[model samples]
Target chain A: MSRESIVNAALFALLIAVPLGALATDEPFIITLATRAVILALAAVGLNIALGIGGLVSLGHAAYFGIGGYAMGILAFHAQSYTPLFEGPFVIEGTKLMPIIWLVAICGGALAAFVIGLLSLRTTGVYFIMITLAFGQMFYFFTISWPAYGGEDGLSIYVRNSFPGLNTLVPIQFYAVCFVLLCAVLWFNARLARAPFGLALNAARQVPHRVEAIGLDPVRLKLVALVISGAVTGLAGALFADLNRFVSPTMFSWQMSGELMVFIILGGTGRLFGPVAGAMLFVLLEYLLGGISDYWLAFLGALLLLVVLYGRGGLVGIFAGKARNHD
Target chain B: MTEPVLSTHALTKRFGALVANEAVSLDLRPGEVHALIGPNGAGKSTLVGQICGAIKPDEGRVQFLGRDVTEQSTRTRARSGLGRTFQISALAMEDSVLQNVVLGAMGAAGTVWHFLRPAMKDLTIRQKAEQALERVGLSDLASLRTGEISHGQRRRLEVAVALTLSPKAFVMDEPMAGLGAEGTRELTALLDELRQEAPILLVEHDMDVVFSLADRITVLNYGRVIATGSTAEIRSDPEVRRAYLGEES
Candidate 1:
């Protein structure tokens, strides 16, 4: 086994063990915190498909994330109120089932990513980043102005929706759901990075001319990656909304996009489990440090500076010693 | 001309005040190496660019496989059986040498979108890439990262990459630039064998390699073709001697 793989395994075990220990001690807040880390990490995993592997620095992923959150919030809200989602021409019923909500969130993410990626992939480097950022802002303001579903005030679910054979209301049960999904998405991202498509996509990121000469359309490949990326982030967004039982335009904010990127960078760019490690560190610091000072973010910024300046591979690099192409 | 596999007709390109390539027309016949030699800034790169669909010719037509490709995208040109190597190496440095060659073969195999299965697991692609690597004597280094290879090895790897396409015609820009004497000799020999597989349009500054390997030579100066003929004829052309080859022995 490679050192990186061992570190990855250790990370997985540690994340799982922490919540279990918290569960034993009856510190349910710790379990909730762990669940937040998993959900945020899952969202970053989605971004890594484009940001890390494809070298697409998307600043609008929060649009898809927000869309996912809204899907969950709107559906559960209507289902609880016994109100139809659509009226007049055809009856569209809302659903409280986890699987159905997941499907909806994925589709919403896929659609948004497809449209946005189509236009954004035409430009590259800083232009691509800014274009995506602009699209994200567009969604942010659109959501705030769309007043029907609480708009700027946001929508709240009275209770967490049910998953088959599981009471999602239980903190530990919810954490398990998020944990399993995180593992599945991480596996999927890893599989993709090693696939033929992934090889071409990575090549495109480095040298687009070479990719073109090889007869592959770099833009098309990136578009597909963006859609796949958005789908995963969207699913995480839905889970996030369920965690808080609330959805807001804040989900679409550029700050949310930056934070998603932060998770990937903090762990290590392009590493399979980088986002997960980054999220754990991020959430832990936020929790442990929030207790110390109101200006906790100042310390967090300094830590990020230390990592960027000295650590080449983020947190994982510090532990695994800069394993290349591990993803 | 037997309808040369690749042909440019009256291709003209200008960058504002500079005429990078002017009314340049050329052809590459099957199983022959046609070397394009010129001084720096003589429009050899521009002409190569026009042929490979990298730069749009202001006025002209390019045909590949007997079909007009003047307006085709670079990827489209490549898909239509054109292979290209950069003047500078354009490789995915982090990927294995085998992976780089596999990427070179991606367009021909029509499997660039297969997401679930690992590319290395695809026996067909893996073997094809390996065969190309073997031809270039880099098979032993297949699993090594491209960045770990020497400069000369990377040049050979570029040829190995082009081979995977099974290209009908090759557009190689300065394939031998920056190689040592030994590296140049090895590449010359490989390119000699390579022409039997597919015709090559080789652009270079190395006259010895050009004279030894090229079946036909074309001389370009200041965006225009000055002469095109067999190696012997080009060697004695007074106008060519005066214009570009005056410095060489």
Candidate 2:
């Protein structure tokens, strides 16, 4: 087998082995941590589309994540209250099924990203980064002040949403669902990174002038990638909300967006499994450090600074040597 | 004849107090090689930029193939058969040489909407890109990454990219700028062959190549055309010598 295939197989084995070992132990803490890793990885994968391939440093991905969570929380609340979303021509109610909630979350996040991307893409460089961050803050503030869906106090999901042919409340089964979705998204992300749009997106990142010279509009291409990225992350957010059985204003915070970026950097930026590795390391560090001291975040910040300054390519790059320009 | 293929009328561009191009008017006939020569900062590159839609002329018209395309964007102009090679040799360095040519051809092919469809898999685009590489003697190095090629080879790749568009008119800015002696001969030969296929507006600094290759030459100094004539006439013109030729001494 080729080196890449061998590496992939080994990775796949580790993914199955580690999770299976966690399941065999029946330890709720380990299972829950594993589930969180998968969900957070999914979110990071979304940002990778824009950040890795498109070269768009969106400091506002948390906005989409929060939007996804809110979609789930708001729908569940309205459904529990037995109130229709709108009393006009059609009555839109919510469901407790995982797929339905995920769909709403993805669509909500994608729509918001499309609108934000349209405005943000008008500017480039630092302006684009700042505009996306501003838009994200706008959404966060709106959610905090809206007061309709528990506002600052947040909402509690009374029960874990059901999936077809499974008792989702069971920690193992729920972890399995999250694992499958994460794998599916990773597969999809891999395919997209090799696709034509992905090529154009990478080309735009390297030299936008060349992309434009080839008659492809860079703005439109980036916006499409951003929307797709936001949708994927948003779907993960819905699953996260269901997993935690709670959603709050903290979901929309810029700190969450920074954490998402940090996750990608920790694993390896632009590498296929970078987000996965990053998410695992991030959560493990948080868990370990949180146990040691309340000021763990300061340590994490110092570590990230050192990585950014010295280790440009994160852990995967260090282990794998240099990644070929795959895009 | 045939609407002159490409024409510019009193094209002027200014950056604050500096005039980059001052009412530069020129016409390129189909199947002709027109050379634009000037010393550094004589506005030859700026004129090429305006013609290629990279920069807008302040108060003039640019007509390409009978249409006034002065207001069009760079991509629009390229799609309409006006191709350009930058002086800096701007090829997609991450992509293979073949892929860069493929991208150029795909630009003219149609709107590339389907991302999943591999662009290189198209038989026609592949054939055209291969043909372009062959014309520039780069067929052997087609699969090499653009960044891996030698500087002269990259220059040829840039020309190959422009050729893949099957352009009616090519605006090449300093095609021989950084080429060594042997590389310059190869490029001169390539330009000679290209002149048979389409009109070329060659912005060049190499006098030997320009004098030998150009059917006509226009010399600009200080953003204005100082001389326009046959090679023999340009060589003998006292005013042209005083402005540019004497400076070389």
Candidate 3:
């Protein structure tokens, strides 16, 4: 195998082993934290497809993430309450199965991303960033006001969603599922990055006019990347909801979107495993700092500012040097 | 006689109160090099933009391959066989030289949506891209990052990208700008060789290269064509001499 393949494999194995080991210790705190890290890393990987490889600075990934979580929450509530989703010519009901909830979450997120991308891509640069953030805020406010599924109080699943063959109530099995999903998303992301669509997307970012001059439209390519990103992130959100057995408006906040970007930036933009490293560091710092002080987030904010200004490549650059290959 | 491959009629553009291009009319025939020369701020770039559909002319029409393209997007214009190179080489710096050429070919192929297909694995696209690089004498540097290549090589790569489209007409804006004598000589030879295949609308300031390579020359001053004639005629015309050639003389 090539050095790159070996390194990637080793990283993947390490990610799985670390979380599994933590769960084996029978410590609820550690298992919960590890699960959160794995889920957040998956979300970061999704954003990286667009932001890192495609060079799209979408500030609305939280909308998809939140939608995914809400799908799980709303479905579980209706399933437990024995209520139908809608009453009309045809009745729509909810299910508590993990796979079905994941599918609904991903599809919903992708659709939302498609609409947001269509409008945001009309402008470029900082305008695109702000527009995405605006859309995300709109979703956040809507979720906060909507009273059907617990509103601002949030919705609790009561019973965690089930997978086909495994006992998802077991922390280890649940963590394993999350781990497998994270790895799958990462693999898919890497494959997409090396594909022709990814090449055109990157080319559009670097020299859009040249891409156009060669007969490719930049806006269409970017929108496709955005949709893929949203779908992947939404899948992570479903996993997150299952992990917590709850979903809330906090999932759709700008802070969540900023954190996702931070994960990519911390690892190194456009580098595979960058999001994994960044997520681990971010969660670890939050855990350690929260134990010590109430103002830990302030410290994180300062640290992020420094990283953005000084350590532009993030931790991946520190260890791997500059990313020689495209993500 | 067959219609010209590309034509611009009464192309006029305004930026606020200033007229950047004023009723400029031009034509490009097949297998010929038409040079547009003028002093600084003569609206050559503006005309190029209008012709390539990057900017719409306020009061004129651009025709490509006998179809009106004045309202077409830049990508549509390119798909219709109008290829252009920028003044500053606009290559993807992070990608390899081979990848850059392949992107150009892929743009022409219109297969950018094949998300699962590896671009480098496509033998046909790679072959065409390599052939384009070879034509520009850049095959040896194919694996190198575009950022690492010499400025002159990047400029040549720009032309290679335009050539990869097998365009009916090539619109080059200052392809020789910032190149040394050796680089200029190399590009001049490449342009000469390309003239046998497709017509080139070259907007250049190098009078020496212009006089030697251009079959016909159009001189613009203050957004108006002051003279259009053979190189010999342009060089001797009293008005052309007084307006532009006087400075070089």
List the candidates' TM-scores in order: 0.98, 0.95, 0.97
On residues B31-120, what C-alpha lDDT tens digit does candidate 3 reach at each position? 889999998998998999999988989998999999999889999989878889999999999999999999998989887778776888
Model 3 residue B224 CA deviation (Å) reads: 1.2
Better of 1 and 2 by TM-score: 1
Interface RMSD of each: 1.7, 2.5, 1.8
Residues A87-183 of candidate 2 have per-residue lDDT tens digits of: 7687788678788888989999899899999989999889988998898888888888988888888999898888999999998889899889988
User: Model 2 over residues B42-84: C-alpha lDDT tens digits?
Assistant: 9988898888887888999999999999999988988888878
Model 3 segments more than 4 A misplaced? A1-10
Which residue segments of model 1 deviate by more than 4 Å?
A: none
lDDT of 1 by residue, A176-258 (tens): 99999999898888889889889999998988889899888888988999999999999999999999999999999999999
Worst 10-residue lDDT window for candidate 2 chain A reads A1-10
- For candidate 1, give the lDDT of residue B51: 92
Q: Give the top-scoring candidate (lDDT).
A: 1
Q: Which sequence of candidate numbers ranks them by lDDT, best first?
A: 1, 3, 2
- List the pairs of residues colliding in candidate 1: none
Native-referenced TM-scores of chain A, all candidate models: 0.98, 0.95, 0.95
Each prediction's DockQ against the real complex: 0.73, 0.52, 0.69
True contacts kept of each: 0.81, 0.42, 0.76
Query: How close to the true structure is residue A252 of candidate 3, measured as C-alpha lDDT?
Result: 96
